[model samples]
Target: MEEYKIRIVKTIQYIDSHIDADLSLEKVSEVSAYSPFHFHRIFKLVTGETLQSYIIRKKIEKSALHLAVHKNMEIKDIYWDLGFSNHSVFCKTFKKYYGLAPTEFRRSAPEKFHKILQIQSKNGQVDTVFSQYICNIENLLNWTKMNLKIEVKEMPEMNLASVMSLGIANVEPSFNLLIDWAKKKSLFPRENVKMISVYHDSCKITPLDKVRIHACMLLDERLSKQEGEVFPETIDGGKYIVGSGEVTLDDFEQCWVSMFLWMNENNYSTRRTFPYEIYHTNFKEHPEGKMIVDFCIPVH
Candidate 1:
């Protein structure tokens, strides 16, 4: 599973760097090291959208960002640069996806424009529109008031076994795979195990299909490479700001957002290492179905 996720990540990265170029299935599948047929199926299963749809959405999104940030650039130029063949095609596709023409969207508030991209939900379902998702995320901000505590501490180096998931909504499968592997290896007895999740990309900055989340667990002694796709890595020791709380999966994203906001408000700068979460309560065993987690963000 890690191998498949890594392939998708690499393919998405390739697409991101070459968004203006031709991105046919054959080309993308080649980058992923999977045959076109197999790649198409797995890509859809993992990302909640067919590969072509993802590419089109990304191209349109890029055009939207260009429209919002580059006010002086011509719409035609933006469309062309984003790989759209012509103005009419770009306008039609953009309006269909975002419900707003480029010119009109540019004239409107920037916040609304940023919310234009539709979210690709997991389970092959899109239950809410982009605006509704934003509202839901806004509502989650209230979770910060529920006895959240944060402090700064230094952490020691540790070994980890991990699996990467391609997007936020698609993280559960990776976690499940890792847990199943651990169980099979008898790496249990909760007290001796530490579960952590490392986020490789910020959703706010990266496109959804390109985001990466690493589901990890600490390993005491080095074990030989396991059969399946598990990654063995070491996290460097560091000074970090730790935020602890009981939060449902739905509130997790907002928790991180609030932590970053807190750091900004308190005049702390984040370090180069990726922010991670240390789970104090087992996910399935949470009494209230809310995980007890410590969000650890490396600080200078």
Candidate 2:
């Protein structure tokens, strides 16, 4: 299983590096050294996305980033450069995925753009906003009652035991499984265990069912082989913008949206590491019935 995961990672990296090149199944499967039929199944199993869907999402995301950062570039040029065949096709696909045409998205404020992307589309139209307060910086500040403070801090490296879940809302089950395994092993004093969830894909661009969620527990070293779905890995240390707040499950999406808006407003670009959530409270039994979490995004 670990070998399969590594092969998928290499294929993902290859696709990313050659995003503008032909990424057909035959070519990608060849890169992974798997038979095309087996590669398709394993790719979807490991990454929670079919190979074609992954490629399309990456192309669209790259185009969106170009649209966000290169203000003066023509939308048609941007889409074509990212491998879209034509302007009309790009516009149609962008609207289908982001709920707004490229031109409208480009004109929107950063916060508004982010909010639009977060909206779940229904029948080819964006039906609502993720949160009313996600429209602008002033609204976000007002909604948080001026208490949404973000600080940039240097964090040390971490070794973690992790379990992966495919859907955003399905993460709790994975966390529960990890915790059960931890208890059986007597891995730590309950009071000292640190709970975290690492996000490996953007909800805005990736389908909800295909988003990668890693429920993790901080550990000093790798655990010996144990049953169930948990795996061990290391996270590199870096500078991160940490935003702490008392929030409910409903507030999770907006919290990260607000942090991203803040980063864009402050001209702080993100590093390649996945963003994560660190729980500081027993989320299931919090006195306020809200999770106390630190939203950490690696940034430069």
Could you say which candidate leads in TM-score? 2
lDDT of 1 by residue, 65-117 (tens): 88887889999889878878888999999999889988998887475555554
Taking all chains together, each candidate's TM-score versus the true structure is 0.52, 0.54
Clashing pairs in 1: none
lDDT on C-alpha atoms for all candidate structures = 0.74, 0.73
Model 1 regions more than 4 Å off? 1-145, 223-227
Worst 10 residues of 1 by lDDT: 123-132
Q: What are the RMSDs of all candidates, in order?
A: 14.4, 15.6
The segments of candidate 2 whose C-alpha lies over 4 angstroms from its true place after superposition are: 1-137, 224-227
- Candidate 2 backbone collisions, by pair: none
**Candidate 2 lDDT by residue in tens digits, 171-195:** 8899888888888889744676799
